[model samples]
Target: MAQKQNTLRVGLVGAGIGGLAAAIAIARAGADVTVLEAAQELGEIGAGIQMTPNAARLLRAWGVDKVIGDNLVRFEELNLRRKDGTKVGGGPTIRVEKTLGQPWWLVHRAHLHEGLVDVARKNGCDIHIDSRVASISYQTPGPVQVQTERGATFSFDLLIGSDGVGSIVRRTLFPSVKPSPPTTNCAYRAVVPYSQIRKDPSLVELVSKPTMEVWMAPHAYIITYPISAGKDFNMVLSHHRPNPVIAVEDVDMNDFRNDYRDFDPRIRKIIDMVPTAKRWPLLVTGPLDTWSSPQKNVVLMGDAAHSMVNHMAQGAATAMEDGAFLGRVLRETVSGRLSLAEAITIYEKSRMPKAYFKQQVSFLNGYIWHLPEGQAAINRDKAMEVELKGEQPMRTPNLYVDPTTVLEVYGYDAEADADEAIRSFLEQHESKDESTGITKKEADKILNWFLPEEERFLIPSKF
Candidate 1:
């Protein structure tokens, strides 16, 4: 008789955009999910989050695209400009309305979380808003043990640390490594009133137009993208190092404006018009050696795995991608005859390389904002010129979407993908058996080829 599969239970820490999204996807897959939020209340007071088409495509597949569509400012083009206001070169969006099957939107962070929270609740996820995760236990092959600040304890079959870069789950799993050290790069984020920029026709034109605009300077760059249905502009002004940390409690422009030196007068005017501005230091985090820990059950996702420079404006998008991928992998394991440990190996083996590639890309693209002696600036302009000509030299899509094309992505059919991964594995194994009697070591080498070249380095050669 077929052994009845255990009901997969999941515990997710941090109910930020990524955690909430994970809860919704996992619950929808009929897996039990419980999400814990440290904050007493869920709120997003910061500026805008840029969710590109690759992330949007996955959101659409999960059935929340309508919620995303309701809060979109579909950009028809993306314009790049120099400090003197000369056009560096801009191009039509590959993800404009009707292009990638859905319109990409930039909504306020809090609102997006609210939508996902509702979806999670409706899909049967247990969400506790006021609870804080104090610690985690990962010493066994069972569910991770979570202790909340309020002394509440819970356990589940899978633990996902979707928390921000300073994840407690990460620390518990890998205690020796220093947590993502705070960086010297600080960001002053704000959302200005539309009427303030709307009065100026030229500024209004840029803000009103359906596009993401970047004004690059010697040491800094300002990214302004439309959100709130084109009525509001979400602006993120960032620069290079040694910046002191800013308090998150309130908006203080006095200290924040120090970074905006020599910016355009209009840009200054918009900055002056913002009612609230909060600053935070930017940090980059890489993949940990043990994503699944000694327990072999808990996994970290989103910023907990790879935190990149904000240059790509993909902090949230990457997290959403993590949630979607996790759901797909778990669904396959439940349906395939594989054990949870085997499924998680497949998950880490599949996702780590993709996440690592994105981290590297973010690091590379970050320099485009600051070009010493204009060398990097020249490369930027050249690429833009090529793009404007309706051509691209490297086939690099905006946001560099090479990670989404993995077999895990194309083969993701919920349960079917697991069946297929297994089917493909067995078929090849059988063929080998019929031919020359392949060893277990040979079988693993063939199966692991599906993982990226970087992660393929993880398996020690046993043959």
Candidate 2:
């Protein structure tokens, strides 16, 4: 397969962080990109998010660092304390910069989303608000048809599903797969303005540092950090619900206070000062069998492919990686260096391992963060103390003692990994082929082999 002279049209469903990032990345690579968002207006919807070095590197490379830099707060450490403010675990995170060559930053979700949207538009991506994708149809040897809610249909060379955990594209692909019910875990998020909290002396101490503060408790934990240039505090409290499944969207001050009644007094006041809070019913999707279509022109990225536990704060970071990595693959495809199948296969192979690995780690992190009263929990605190006292290596027999673990996750380079994957795929296939490289037909056959039988449906049209 050689480069096509015509510009590639890419249609992205969902204009969340992943979709916006993908639009920018694809547009930067000279593809005509359009993003369909179901919302009436695109704005920030979440409280806060951490952008690790791995994700920041991609944002900087995409030339939107400045757009998101204004309200960013650089955190130098991650401090873990008990519910009552007793120091227990975590360590200085400045080493993340040393190991990964980039700094850790926190920003309000709205700021980051706005910046990404602006950058994507500046990159010439057509962002269509209120355009909800109703269905997608594959057309072999031609464009894929994307029908939206408004009874309009558009065709593109590729279709990307960057929608969140409840993804229509994913459902369309695996119609038999139902969304998993909510888990026992539930999270409450609130942002306390520094101007309002500064009046309280007890809360002043909490906001004194740029560190990511984690307060561990029995069957619950709270993570708080500064964002909006340290003008506001981003707080997240994750705890087990009494019921197996509970959906709490509206905020209730009394409920929040009751949940963390035993928490630090300062944190209690911080909770009291919050005007409102949003509750998130933590749900986990079963591991997806596949994230791409048989033809590879249509794919799922971000939460649509692999939604994980948020304990590791890698939700947004992993989504960014998805978009960044896919961008790299599409760039090569646009350049005629590889067929769509080969490029997408390489992307899927390289990204699935990292995404799923993080997903598992995130679940483990939640377990460790919210350990109930037991010898195991006591041992964890003891291990953290030992690591902090320099009496033991960071790799103590506890999840909370390791700083290198953070470095490992935050140091991954999506573009480099994708490039390496492409090289390996080329070498392996070229060796098997008698021609200069794998033909388009050969690439499709390899792709089809990896697809499930259900996905082997024929496209009645030339794609």
lDDT of each: 0.67, 0.79
| Candidate 2 Cα errors over 4 Å, as ranges | 1-5, 139-141, 244-248, 390-392, 396-404, 431-463
Model 2 lDDT, residue 437, Cα: 43
Clashing pairs in 2: 140-462, 140-463, 141-462, 141-463, 142-462, 142-463
The weakest ten consecutive residues by lDDT in model 1 span 402-411
Cα-based TM-score, every candidate = 0.83, 0.89
Q: Quick one: best TM-score, which candidate? A: 2
lDDT of 2 by residue, 355-390 (tens): 888888888888887888789878878777864663
Write down the worst ten-residue block by lDDT for model 2.
Answer: 454-463
Cα error of candidate 1 at position 183, Å: 6.2
